[model samples]
Target: MSPYSPVAEPPPRVAARLRRPRRPRRGSALVRRAASPVALLVLWQLASATGVLSPDKLAPPAQILRAMVEEWHKGTLQAATGVSLQRVVIGFALGAVVAVVLAVVAGLSRIGDDTVDPPMQMLRTVPHLGLLPLLVLWLGIDEAPKIALIALGVTFPLYVNTVAGIRGVDRKLVETAGVLGLSWWGRLRHVVAPGALPSFLVGLRLSLGVAWLSLIVAEQINATSGIGYLVTDAASFGRTDVVVGGLIVYSLLGLATDAAVRLIERKALAWRLA
Candidate 1:
């Protein structure tokens, strides 16, 4: 090729350099993520200071923060948080176990699917909260009903995702496992479980969110303790600051849990990244 020929192209390294997109600096990215929330808080503070926002209607962020500190000093904050956390943990564990077992049973066999799935589908259609009255009647106004409600809320999302994951596993992979002379348990351990893991983790994230929401609703049902009870008591006394603080705690808890699950997903699915 002549030196002046149009056919002559840039070197591979040069071409790759031209094609690659520039990524923002890590510090800049962090600042960008923090910017919006900080701006919103500032705007809120300004609105409250100018009397554009009514304290009775909604407590200012400053007041909410102060109220939270007061609650902490009184020890109500710690107690409520611990109680709420316990309920969520127990409820989530129960829901996860039931959902996974059902998903496995239905996913692994046609007979199991026919026997188990239809009724579950029907139950999924009914609003979980609608069952609260019946649950209260049967389980009484106690921890049992509250925990049951949370578990009920957590079950469907996990079940649907897990079942889909299992069913979606590649036929070729299963065949390959069989050809390799892997026993049923071996195939399940190596192939099916790992293949289904991503979906199961996704379901877990969703279920955790649902679990928190359900706890909020459940605690509203004659709750004697927990964040819900604290908020309810604050509302009854017209302590808007305390009520707002309680809500902030709930939101922060949800965000924290979701972040934890995301971290787990990254670690669990590192093979995909590779």
Candidate 2:
């Protein structure tokens, strides 16, 4: 070895310092995430007070908060939220069952793929909004139409993601399973389900969002209750504060549901992360 090398090693302490991973800032990430929204509310309140933004056009955050409290006291907010949550839960459950069944059928067999995929592909392209009038005509201006719309909206994304997930499972792993004398059901239970789970969860998040959106649309026409009904009723009465409060309710509900799904994912997919 040459006595004088082109490069020299750093001291162990210096090298250790260079290799150390930077620690994240010490604080709750949730607080950091909330900073932007809190700042926006402050700006909105300032603008409303300064007359830079008209309360007639957009109610101040303070007014909206007051109106929300009043609605809660009167039981309107609680009732409307309950009804909306019930509708979403029922519709989502039904849609999830249907989507998983369809995905499994199509993903597992050529015959099923040919029979089920074509129709599904055709139907997914038809906007769910356009179906509202038709659904009302077919099912009447009742909870049935609203629930059906939400179910339809929740179905497609899950089906697509689940099917893709199953098909995307490693062919080599599948072959190995077969060579190991595993039955079809054994292969599916042991090898396929876990592989497909991540994609299915992604689909679940998308479906939940669509379910909320569909509920919003469905509640717009012939809706006697829900956050959407509250907004529409407020609009008719020219109560900007109530209207804004209803919208805030919808936003908060959406965030809460998404957070729930994320919690589920964190727990269910912990193995994958490991």
TM-score, model 2 to reference: 0.85
lDDT for each residue of candidate 2 in 51-103, tens digit (9 for 90 to 100): 99887799899999999999999999999999999999998898999999999
State candidate 1's TM-score. Answer: 0.88
Note the Cα lDDT for every prediction shown. Answer: 0.87, 0.86
Give the local distance difference test score of model 2: 0.86
C-alpha lDDT of candidate 1 relative to the true structure: 0.87
Q: What does the lDDT read for residue 144 in candidate 2?
A: 96
Q: If scored against the real structure, what TM-score would every candidate get?
A: 0.88, 0.85
On TM-score, the leading prediction is 1
Give the Cα error of residue 86 in candidate 2, in Å: 0.9
